[model samples]
Target: MLTINVAFLLAVIVLVRLRRRTEARSRSDERFTVVIVLALGVLIAPTPVGEGIFDLLGQLASGITGASR
Candidate 1:
């Protein structure tokens, strides 16, 4: 569990640094970044419009884990 947590933390840090570098080169009117963040936020969080997405992901994950046996 400790190793898994450390790995997850490292992964998050690396991803954040990479994303920051990527965003640093973009202009203020970055519609692509805005849209991508909005879509990702909506997908990961619960809202009326996001409920279906969350449900689908949950079902998919469940199916994948269930099939691993």
Candidate 2:
């Protein structure tokens, strides 16, 4: 049995979208890319990579907040 990792697929989609020329993408194309990137984030949020990202973001946020005080 082969399991398809959705996050992997989404990452590929993101990469492909990023490789395209920015000037060639229309508004709808930009919206679709946003949707795909959001979906990719959702798909990745349950895994170890997600945890690392969360941790990194937390640290960055804390640093920013701390610096402001």
Candidate 3:
């Protein structure tokens, strides 16, 4: 029996799609990529890795705001 993780599959797809030349992608292709990436985000958002990313981004945002003030 083979078990595949969907999030892992989507991440691979996103990477492959992004590696293509920008000029090679039509508008619809680009939109499809965006949808895939968004789906990947939703899949990742509840995991510990996602929470860590959120914390890191929050720290960076606060640091920028603090510097500006």
Candidate 4:
């Protein structure tokens, strides 16, 4: 749920920034960004590579929590 919410926030930020700028772009720009953002989501997900990162962070978090911190 939080992940979806964060994605929404990021999408809004992307749209808002693009909206604030004054420039003309081809349709491809929009399409490309859509694809790129989707790829970013996959990359951020807990795939093989991402899982290691998540595990490391989880360890850090457990340490910080220190038995119900």
Candidate 5:
């Protein structure tokens, strides 16, 4: 049996989209790419990696707020 990590697949898609030439993409293409990336994020958000990301973002946000005060 072969198992695949969906997050990894999504990351690949996101990277490919990012690497594409900006001028070649239309508005709808941009929107579709955003949707795909958002879907990837939702898929990732329930895993351990997602938890770490949330924690890191939280700390970063607090640090920014603390620095600005």
Candidate 6:
């Protein structure tokens, strides 16, 4: 039996979609890409990788604020 992870598949799709030339994308194409990205975020948010990303972003935000002050 072979099972593919949906999040990984979506990530691949997002990569492929983004690789196209920016000038070639229409408004609807951009909207579709946004929807795909949001879906990917939702699928990944409960996993350990998502928690790590959250921590990393938090630290980055704090560092930026500290540097500004």
Indicate whether candidate 2 or candidate 6 has the larger TM-score: 6
Candidate 5 positional error at 43, Å = 0.7
- What lDDT would each prediction earn against the true structure? 0.60, 0.95, 0.95, 0.68, 0.93, 0.99
lDDT of 2 by residue, 22-67 (tens): 9999999999999999999998898999999999999999999999
Per-residue lDDT over 1-69 for candidate 6, one digit per residue giving the tens place of the 0 to 100 score: 999999999999999999999999999999999999999999999999998999999999999999999
TM-score head-to-head 1 vs 2, winner: 2
Ranking of all predicted structures according to lDDT, beginning with the best and ending with the worst: 6, 3, 2, 5, 4, 1
Candidate closest to the true structure, highest lDDT:
6
Task: Return the clash pairs for model 5, or none.
Answer: none
lDDT of 5 by residue, 1-69 (tens): 999887798899899998999999999999999998999989989999999999999999999999999
Worst ten-residue run, lDDT, model 5? Answer: 4-13
Indicate the residue-level lDDT of 42 in model 5.
97
Using Cα atoms with residue i matched to residue i, what is each candidate's TM-score against the true structure?
0.39, 0.85, 0.94, 0.36, 0.91, 0.98
Indicate whether candidate 2 or candidate 6 has the larger lDDT. 6
lDDT of 3 at 52: 96
Q: Higher-lDDT candidate among 1 and 2?
A: 2
Residue pairs with backbone overlap in model 6? none
Question: lDDT of model 1 at residue 62?
Answer: 98
- lDDT tens per residue, model 3, 1-69: 999989999999999999999999999999999999999999999999989999999999999999999
* Alpha-carbon lDDT of model 4: 0.68
Q: How does residue 53 of candidate 4 score in lDDT? A: 77
Off by over 4 Å in 4: 1-41, 67-69
Q: Between which residue pairs do clashes occur in model 1?
A: none
